[model samples]
Target: MNVMKSTGKFRDESLDFQKKILERSGFGEGTYAPTSLLKTPPNVCLAEARKETESVVIGAIAELLSRTKVKAEEIGIVVTNCCVFNPTPSLSAMVVNHYKLRDNVVSYNLSGMGCSAGLISIELAKQLLQVRPNSYALIVSTENINDGLYFGNNRSMLVSNCLFRMGGAAILLSNLTSDSHRSKYCLKHIVRTHKGSQNHCYNSIIQEEDDDNITGVTLSKNIMSSAGQTLKANISTLGKYVLPFSEQLRFVTNFVAKKLFFKVRVIKSFTPNFMLAFEHFCIHTGGKAVQDEMQKVLGLSDWHMEPSRMTLYRYGNTSSSSVWYELAYCEAQGRVKKGDRIWQIAFGSGFKCNSVVWCALRTIDPTKEKNLWSEFSTHVTN
Candidate 1:
């Protein structure tokens, strides 16, 4: 399966610029410097965080619905993924309440699924659409980093302070047969891989603390490395399915070229050309190292990594919504085209790795819509 057509929506960028934001937010020097949405203090009350989260969620949904020209009442299913801010009324319920979705609308709230939750939710929506044919499904992925901020000054937790940002994203999915022609892309394939180990690799990055109640999560170094391993395994499994014959040929040819032909390309260095297989790549913006390692491992060119790198530089790591920002950037630049393939890869705790493949359904016209990309494009370097 491939992305036939897809669109993403987020809050306007001018509202939150990366540099000035960190300094004013009281974040430690150079902590939130890399991210546009500055991280707030861990002591920041949950109530304030909840309000901010709801505003972004509502804004994102409204933006998506408006762009897709779909009425809120017409959406038959709603799914939201967020690790922070679990309320008595679930996030999905809140969405239903705000939008006044139909009583018959199917809704769910997913918690504790790490960054991979977004991809997992998208896959779940695809499955639901298949079973309940000809229905619209809305999937929202967001993480309120402001609430989860860690002001402990501990290096382990400090990493989160530097990267994570306040952001959310909403997307629409459908199985309407006609949608195959007009929709973004047909739901091609979704691959989920979890490497739960004895050492609590699947442990929650965000936790509930007693007196020392902290909101933000601490992503351990072990969790990061584990994610890389899981992603490699997952993509390999997915590769067996959607990779085109030409891609397979190039992979094999390159492997043989490096080995038997004694080509300058190192035998150990030869890797599958993910860029050759897909026109666009949306790797997770976990960090600079994560993005760089993925580019080196998968043999992706600098151009392929631009969206990921730029998103990280501008928005920091918005967790689940980061990939959507990258995809939005590509669309804004007029880079996406009809029949183009998009590869979205995300890493999360649970030592989880997930990948989704989307192919464009039609050529898209770049629009100067109200989004993070439009404003931050000039600020970012590459």
Candidate 2:
């Protein structure tokens, strides 16, 4: 069981001005913005967004292959995810052409699914490895902010403007027995959960508008609340399947104590220490508030969220690709080691929550490739 991860990122620094974007978008004075929106044109539009996305995907795939010492034609599976850009040619189809991968390779383009698409793509690749041994799977995660930039200055919509930046990540997964000894991590378990809420919850997270003259998509305001509930449920369900017996017993004990003894104080005190179980957490850098909520729920410390926070501050919210940036940060800091455990959590459209857990199979070599964190260390906030 071996896997290699190669990630890529691209941002439109000239388009958005950080300080003005924060104030105009109402993200507050201290809210981090990679670039300001004032510098960017109001009519930049989706066409440009698609072109930038194409560049990142092409560049990322090329970089991944170069680092892995594998040719594009050797890749057996291609999985790409993006929220805003869906062209007639399709992003995956374009990549297939750009890379000239084998004609028989399975390629998929996942759209409309929000940030959680990153983990979902990884899960898809892991499943492929089970059936097709020695196969190579390329997973690319990205988000196009230019398409979703809001002009009305509504706080809810403006949040997207301040938080999202241009970014993408490409990862290479393989089940080759030969690479097992050198690969950094092995995929262990993946849990995906979706919530169905009609009261503008789903509409808030993912919206389709029809105005006769034009049709467009916009994010609703209720996404954070809806996502919080969904994540709690998903974590509980996943815990039942993966938590160690001791932790399970503790949870059960607290429940029983509260029910029988009516000891509300003691029972309510029981919360699973997720961070204690996993050595590292690559939580989606969707926003500062999202990260804070996840940290409080998961019982993680400032250090646990350092990678996520740094990624968010440096790259803004790259949506699906943000988790990979956090993962890369941990690796560059030499935080991951053989047999260490890592947990990746992401929330996206469809009111969806997805999680993936992996264990390092071999030591990571920082010198082997470019690292987003290592390069941005000077600028990242502690």
Candidate 3:
């Protein structure tokens, strides 16, 4: 609930760039960036990156441990992900050492997986839990902007500076049925689709040195198009597991008609009514354009997108952890309820579209405790 805001010094430093890009970026005035960037001199360095990583990861992990009432030694697996920063001692290793976890704990560090890495981590944890019964897995999602700062005038690269911000989330998953009584939700399905083999999709968002020799992640003009393709593919696979029979039959009928009977463009592609399958949606707050495109493609209404839009306005694109912030926003607003289903969809650099489905296990009270969006009503307009 006590999410840190960027210092004035850092805001002042980024003011010029923000002004230039904010108009077209779909971001509000309140988006966050890291205070570590305000140091005497700023560039990608291990010290600054490490400091930012520890601040968010440790805080989130501490809160998770307290809420779950689980000790660090009880965690049988640890996974931490950050797209741009990978130090000598992995982030997972740092966490294990700092928390003094058990010596035999399985640890994995993931990097360069982009914003969808958080969901990827969850899928990994689910697999690990199946192998080891009655064990807990800790997953941390974060992004460090210290090394991702772009100095060049390349507008595409400069967009990252305006969009990405400091944020992290820690999640604890357990295989024990006993813990299910206390858990907020139960994992139902996870479907991941990757279009990395395609040249255009692979280069849509990439980290490389620009012409000026300044290294940064560049966003290509084809990013939206690439994402759309990946989403289509992902939904095709996911629909089998989540969509209602009526929706599935319609989709199949449309497909058969298009191939067998209709040669003229009479039938439009069927976008299964996802609204029937899930009560809530946590679309990645990648950018304004991406959010808008998703809303239109999925036939979603304004209410369905409020969490994503507001999360972007409040946190900027926190990379992999953005989805969690959106989910927290929904909880703080008292929108979640027992038996309701939530679908989290995330897009990342590999032109990946990943989704995680959860069924609420118990009723969630908005006023039960403070949350990331505890003050959301006072500050956010919508």
Candidate 4:
């Protein structure tokens, strides 16, 4: 009787935690879940999970290929990332088999990299393009929420069940300068910070079985602290590439004064105004709390955060693809202009923070674009 009472209290606490999270998560009613998860009892199985990914990846790729009018045979490289739900043949193989890509096509599948895996895929494609000139690389990013849902009474894991929703993106890249005229953006820089060497950071987010033996991903409170540390480390390198000489010099002087000269109290260190480096920022949309924290840390106005905020409200935290969705939101709003620099910041399970920079190659006309939030543009709240 005593054990039963304690278990019931834990269950109640988990339910209360989930309810509170949902109340403040910034998720809208339209956010999605896989058809399988929508069932009365939530039918979870390997077969159903494949169907969920197939429907998303195929639709995303088919739409991209149709809009760009690119033949699958022309794709020389394929990269796909899903933090969970990796199968035997792999998602890259699935894409190749479905589209019948050429036999010589190079493909890779990335897993367990967390929400930052999308930018990682883009970085991978960029490197592949450097070697194979005039080639097109296709990158796909998505998360399988069906496999990640937690029915156990672990309060930490329940946070994911309330925050993540179904979302994905398909991106096409090319090295052919001839395609420049029609390109939307040009890749500029990438900086990745990994903190897995620290035991706390590595264990901050994990998939494990609870006392009842049901498996789910536990999101420790330390996850946010790990993310904050990674962000500082990532921007340290990224700032060198993007910040102007003036900002860089100021940072260096402060570091030298504080560290080398042993006068920490004499000179105050500060975070550089990233706004001066990029016109837009796509902060990782892990949850509303994360966004709120970022807003305070980065000192961004609502205008700068509009794309990321609206993406979260409409799509929830879609894992790796959230950044692309934020980018699409910017394009749909017609905010992308030629020569404008955009920054994508991503945080993942390795306690990693990664940055990807892009410069707009051409002004994006919203009428011709078909973003997930395109139809709702007229009704999107500020």
Top-lDDT candidate index: 4
RMSD of each: 9.4, 7.9, 4.7, 3.2
Which regions of candidate 1 are displaced past 4 Å? 1-43, 198-200, 203-216, 244-270, 367-371, 375-382
Stronger candidate by lDDT (1 vs 3): 3
Candidate 2 lDDT over 1-382, as tens digits, reads: 0111111111233134434455443122233222322343233545666767877788878778777788887889989998877776878888888888788889889998988998999988888778887799999998776566543323344345466777799999998889877677888888898886556557766444333222345557677788877887787777786678888789888778888889455457467878656989999887777888888888899999998877776666788988888888888877788888898999888888999989988767665545766765445443
In order of appearance, the predictions have TM-scores of 0.80, 0.84, 0.92, 0.94
Tens digit per residue, CA lDDT, model 4, 58-143 = 99999999989999999999999999889889999999999999999999999999999999998999999999998999999999
After TM-score superposition, the amount by which residue 295's alpha carbon in candidate 1 deviates from its true location, in angstroms, is 0.8
- Positional deviation of 259 in candidate 4, in angstroms? 2.0
Better of 2 and 3 by lDDT: 3
lDDT of each: 0.72, 0.74, 0.87, 0.87
Q: Candidate 3's residue-wise lDDT over 153-254, tens digit each? A: 566777888778888999999988889788999999999999999999999999988775767788999998999899999998999999999999999998
Using lDDT as the measure, what is the rank order of every candidate, best first?
Answer: 4, 3, 2, 1
Segments of candidate 4 deviating more than 4 angstroms: 1-12, 260-268
Clashes of each: 19, 13, 0, 0
Q: Which scores better on TM-score, 1 or 2?
A: 2
